[model samples]
Target: MKNKFVQILVTGILVASLPACKQRPDNDAARAKGTGAPTIASTLHFADEHTTATYETAINKFFKNGLFRSGFNGSYLVAKEGKIIAEGYNGFLDPVTKTDSIGEHDAFHLASVSKTFTGMAVLKLWEEGKIGLDDDLSKYFDKFPYPGTTVKMLLSHRSGLPNYTNYLEHYNWDKKKLVTNLDVLTSLYTMHPPLQFPTGKRFSYCNTNYALLALLIEKVSGKAYHVYLEETFFKPLGMTDTYVFSLDKAETAMPSFEWNNRRYGLEFMDLVYGDKNIYSTVRDMLKWDEGLRNGNLFRQSTLDSAFQGYSYEKAGARNYGLGWRLTEVENGKKIVYHNGWWHGNNTVFIRLLEEKATIIVLGNKYNRGIYRSKQLCDIFGDYRQSNKTFQELENESSNGLAAGGSQ
Candidate 1:
């Protein structure tokens, strides 16, 4: 039965990866009017029976002994060479109610991982000649306080803007009132908060950077951030179960829980979409990973910029890319990935770019074990000897020690 399940799963992934007969009109129009870049399909690599069984055994052992035993409540999917090798959904959508078990199609808040989409959307605008990466914030917003910061700086988290999460609460904004992207901007303008550091001096991983990037996307594209993402990436990629969270969808969205299984209530910061609030399933995230990998979404140069390391001021293997976190590993290879935490939600999205392996774990219930999913890199390639293990890097991020770590 297990072997049969693996075969069926692999076959389904193979079928999904193929080109569809019908394409969305807007997506086709965007591709034509935009980059005009050709899509490059990855060479599919299906593991043999023995290899597949080996992978399943190791993955099952890891989850059963590690995550599952530690009270993980979410879904996980592992893919190698663009093929689904092993996947599972465990626990309930609402732990308190003990109902609605999690499934493949359920979406959990991506937290900072949502930055990946915001970053790419800005780059997409850049590719279309609608915006320049170096354009100043003053160009878009009247009386913008930050003079030197540019679109590129925001994408790479080098803008040095104070984090809204910190300032909004510190300034004693009404806790009952939900904050929006524009409200964040208004507060920045009115308060004129001191910059964390001079623009472009260093990388600081501020949520305010991406929040403003979302506004930039809307200003340049003349579409709301959520609308732009849906029309540009999600719909085109067929990520049916993904979306930017809104109050209207709140009731239907999956609820997050604490480590003790207590459900977390919504807060003032919950409404903001760019810095976080993207809800996506593991499979939908895989489609996103494959979409970016296949070169169908943007020009090769654009994608390269998004994944390239931008911060070297600090002596460390971990660095921030445009919308992703990177870990420089042995043999000059880099693990391009992002992990997210917001409320009780923790998400892991990893891509071993060279080996074409992907690891995705989304848990509505907080579990530090979720970050350890990066350790699975060892199963795909020679990532064992990196200066810092992926697990350690993620641990820092989860504890809010790393820049933009605790999103």
Candidate 2:
């Protein structure tokens, strides 16, 4: 059973990674066209084409093989055209506490993927006329380098700013040291030089883009990043569990575990959360995914711009939009995705716009969740709606004489 699932996962990953999607973002937001970009959902789609029994077979195979280890467990939810079709959770929540961290219900850390929330927060502020897409970022920066960077440029990661010098270059940051939000700004201003590329000139993934934007959220809104997200996005949408966490002390936020010959839980958490502690359960994430797809958080017109991809060059691999990733998958299918990693915990959010389906896989290791998500996508490939039973999976396991897990 494990072998079959692993094979499905590996094959799925190879197949999915082969092609790059083409993305186009409206460079001029000032125009009435309002960031003209490709639509996210297909005009027509079959429910079964998004997810089906075949994909269920693949998903079952993934879960049966102890897909997530170190108790690096996960929660999975599949929805079709704004309806909940399937949801499940597996793995351990607290090793010391021995909690059952199920999927689609329990929250986990989003890591950098939390940037998605940050992105939404920024956009919310913009919609309220509290901020502008093209406002000079440095005008409010405590001690900024480039004075002309805009919110739009930062959202598209086109600001050309350096991310983190103190943490990245310093090597041994004293964990005991309290790295205030201002500390981050000081580090960037002092260590990193001018923007990597001219504003609105190119594409590069930089955390500084959002980290600085986090400040903008505070400066313009008169609220902390965490508080702003809670009020504008989370509270409004009823995401009771999700929040912008700034871990002051070592608190029990993300649960850790070891699996598939790796320690996934804590180390993975660190990467996603940085040193600051932040958390969310799988359940909260499922709610988030649902809200994003259903447009519960933003107007259709607004979300259209938020999820669209922007690129500097006219023709190349697709680029990133404000907070979402836009790409086209196999057979001209459009896929929107974003991933989170922190303290050894990882999660992947995969939404196939053509099918109007969403796939979420969160794990403890680096490659595990990504691998499973792609494989699950392949099995589901073009499937729209899925109908399968756990008993069927059990029967497959029994007849195949297989038990998953790398031996």
What is the alpha-carbon lDDT for the whole of candidate 2? 0.55
**lDDT of model 2 at residue 46?**
22
Candidate 2 local Cα displacement, residue 87, angstroms:
2.8
Over 4 Å off, model 2: 1-55, 65-72, 94-105, 165-168, 171-175, 192-194, 257-278, 312-317, 330-332, 365-372, 378-407
lDDT of each prediction vs. the true structure?
A: 0.77, 0.55
Q: Best by TM-score, which number?
A: 1
Worst 10 residues of 2 by lDDT: 35-44
How close to the true structure is residue 48 of candidate 1, measured as C-alpha lDDT? 51
Q: Pick the candidate with the highest lDDT.
A: 1
